[model samples]
Target: MKKSILTFSLAVSLLACSYAQNIVDGNKIPVAGNVKISLPQGFTTAIVAENLGKPRHLTINPDGSMYVKLARAVDSKGVLYLKDTNADGKYEVIKGFGNYGGTGIYTKNGYLYTSSNQEVFRYKLNANNEVADTEHPEKIITGLKMGRQHETKSIVIDNNDNIYVNIGAYSNSCQQEDRKPGSLGVPGCPLLDSAGGIWQFKANKLNQSYGQGTRYATGLRNVVGLDWNNTTNSLFVMQHGRDQLNTLFPDLFDAKTNAELPAECMYELKKGDNAGWPFAYYDPFQKKNMLAPEYGGDGKKAADASYINPVVAFPAHLAPNGLLFYTGSQFPEKYRNGAFIAFHGSWNRAPEKQEGFFVAFVPFKNGKPSGNWEFFANGFAGSDNITSASQAVYRPCGLAQGPDGSIYVTDDKKGTIFKISYNGK
Candidate 1:
């Protein structure tokens, strides 16, 4: 067979030159360079692209190209479109098209959008903005109501064309049977009317459904990171805090206060803003907003006053997912507009060693949140004693920002895509 196809094309060109000689001085990447991350002083990381399968939300391309979004499909496509063509920041061509999966992606104006836990599409781009009918997208919003524990929609877009979307809350505490440990909670949580919160629609309208969008913010209990913070024009989200909690109040939380009492918020929203899930939660050790033992709370109580609190919180189950907001400029100046967040770590926080798979930072100034939110990129769960989540090896989820001010992250476990840059030492 022609010498076994020339010995399998010379063993795939010597395994692509031993994976490009594992980059050395130039593109870094020894495990996403800066040696297992810990960025801050002069920054520096790489890896660019790797496996890529479950890569959730991502966006970019004003010309830099990225457009990810995939919680499933790959050969059946779920939108990929990488492109770097030798700029050396990595990417190298790649491509895929949309079919339907879920996670939520964005672009705006020229259009690109994405989503699928039950609909919300849109493509049309061309003129170099890429994606112009990658197999006809356009569904703009449909059904949307899938659940079994926070369905993973995660979308965002605002500049007035609107389009939010999040719909989680399938019951972790709205109880009455959901997390049935001591059960109870169900006085008002009518599943928050239709799955937790944040809805809003009409990004050029189209198929629209699920009561034609509008919820815009209600007791959010599962917002895999959202964005649209045009310097505080609003809409920020992150919430994913509400799980077990001492396996359902074992006589008022224990097991290390259920691995550190509730927290993991971030809010910022508006147009109704609720924040309190299943009655209330945010308790970074009584920073307050409590009352959630299925609504009778025994662990210190508090809530009421229509809930609302979190403008920051963090540190309970980690699992943030992704949310950017830097606004480019290549870095420095205290990361311009600030706010990165990508967590995606704890799978229930076992005995507690596993923390957010990292990529945090906050800092925003005139739009709120300034100072103290640190951890600009830490090691993506390559392991810090993660007792579970399949032993963890990269799980930061998704986040983008490159135009020059590099910061791409994505890594739904083994799908890589790092980046990080800074250099001005």
Candidate 2:
């Protein structure tokens, strides 16, 4: 019996060694040092978290735990929690707080901060990354303009501990009345004064109030995907471009050109960066930026000096909802510095057959885009015919990399968190 036990131990050790060797070798799978990554065969997705009430975004703690943000429509009272009860790469419910609102949640310097349509707040977190006490939520800023159009609130922090909140303009394109073209923009566009930009505030201070050393940047329409790029040590965002092309202007843009034109933009934002929204869009097909229809362009010429070109542009109406730069070493070397974008799919590309319902990968070298992106993962649509929105089972809205190097993708439409890992067996 003792001999049999010793053999079992030896077998276990050998198995562990095999896994280690596989991981070391898997790091070299992408031979070209490009964006192409081959997934290991027999790999399956597991649910590491669930029932997260329209989970919108997620961030990882240093210790492999995650803090997720949920949309207000599902739970009007506040957010929910999931703690890894067994430490087996999954989280179990531990605690929750807040009232129903479209706010972003993130952890920095032992504090968990959240933002609502009108205010930004923070709370103290325990060692486990869970809310230790919600006795009160420290209001960081207030008086942020909120409206129906582009109202989903999002927040992020920089290495300097400066908190940034996105206040989206209520109007579609700052039209004279809102969504109407050829109409003069409101002088100075009051929305620019209170919304349509990133507002900076002191993250460590409480009740310090709004409009104090705030106003870090301006001229952003609706930046839902915002993060501090560790590679460049700067803030980056993906903007959902203006919609209803051609229909809003037929003489300038036709159906096919409008469908594949205006590229969804990814910006490396800095102080005083103005990406033309109501004025222009980056046209990927023409391979040159073009002026927005509202400002009057024949869709052939580009307004060079008016707006900054995107570092990366994708197919229009793809609705890039989430962006993450992989810094973890769990994946292959080629993917170590690349960016992952979750496109919530196209709605306006109808009749031409909707597109962009999958996650895409953009290769990055030394903090800049190396080349055009490619579809990294497919089969999310779960069907061949996407005639209507109801037929889609998954619409990826959030992305997070686990401590173990597994990728977590959240489907807002179905409230599912898919954990993708390598097996290499």
Candidate 3:
């Protein structure tokens, strides 16, 4: 027994050494030094941490510390506090808080806020504005509905102390039969009453319910990415465009059209705003909200003017999951006030090579989108083309900007955090 135990310990030590040696040798992993991610000419990239288990949204503190939310609990711990004590651009100190997990997390005013799929909570902060009293967090909002699809609750807090949460529609198209081919859309989609929109509740208020909240916007199918744009003092969101355009309506749409129609859109939201969803979709090619075929559209008719249009539109099914407005001066001047969106990449664009497993930028001027959106960083997937989601090496999931103007990205697949900085090359 003693010899067996000794052998096992020696084997474990050898394995650890081999892994560290691989990293030192600049092999493909530990993924920090030579991860194959491509940034702009003047920017450099490094993996901040890895093996983080389904990391979701992340926020950087004023002091460059970070708080990340995981999609599920790890050893009953969901929230992570990370610190880079040595200033080596790698986070070395890691701490865990609360045995709950969800997709929303942020630090503001004097507290750290996080959420579960069906509730939102806040923890008091220490003097340094870092996490404190984590285990006994106060529940700010409760009783939210989370279904099987689009169940993650992404969150953002505004300047006025209002917190916004997305309640995604569970059904694919609000169809009468729900994704059944040839089924018509339910008129006046009842799902809009509860899901399919953003809701506003007081950030300081405790135990709030859906009945106590106000519907800020309607007709957004599923908004996984949203941010409070301080420049405009309003809410901005990226709507994941609906799917199966050709699979459901083969008579009207072809495989190529299904893969590329109905653009993923970015919208600057205001009170009572409505960005059309089940009833209509924005066609990037036509630059108009085309009536949905499920709603009697023959693939060409435009929806009425009652629906609000998007500020910017991207290719279909790219799954924009993170949004950050650059207020830092790290990169070139063009990046200031511009928006960085992390496309989680596409799983539905079958029969066509997938794209958008990278961070994209949309330049903004005077609080609105100014120029066309472009690729800010690429190569997250480690290849030029991929036919499926499993082939993706790292899917960009969340984004944040550090105090020195560096940007951070999170991957849900391997739970990796990547940091990108401008070196002024």
TM-score of each: 0.37, 0.85, 0.91
Scored by lDDT, model 3 comes in at 0.85
lDDT of 1 by residue, 303-386 (tens): 887877877887678878888888888788777888989888887756656677777888888988876576677766665577
Deviation of model 1 at 263, angstroms: 16
Candidate 3: clashing residue pairs, number: 0
Q: How high is the lDDT of residue 344 in model 3?
A: 97
Which pairs clash in model 2? 76-100, 77-99, 77-100, 78-98, 83-92
Kindly list the per-residue Cα lDDT of model 3 for residues 1-425, writing each as its tens digit: 33443453344335323422211112122243334765556677788888889999999888988999999989888999899899786786478987887999987888888989999999988887676677689999999888889888999999889999999999888999888888999999988988999999999999999779999999999998899899899999999989997779877776666777678999999899989889999987668998999998866689988999999988788999999999998789999989999999987766768877888888899998888777777778876679988888899999998988999999999899998888877
Q: By descending lDDT, how would the candidates be arranged?
A: 3, 1, 2
TM-score quality measure for candidate 3: 0.91
The local distance difference test score of model 2 is 0.69
Off by over 4 Å in 3: 1-35
Model 3 residue 147 CA deviation in Å: 1.1
Lowest lDDT sum, 10 consecutive residues, model 2, at: 23-32
Clashes of each: 1, 5, 0
The model with the greater TM-score, 2 or 3, is: 3
- How far residue 254's Cα lies from its native spot in candidate 2, in Å, is 2.1
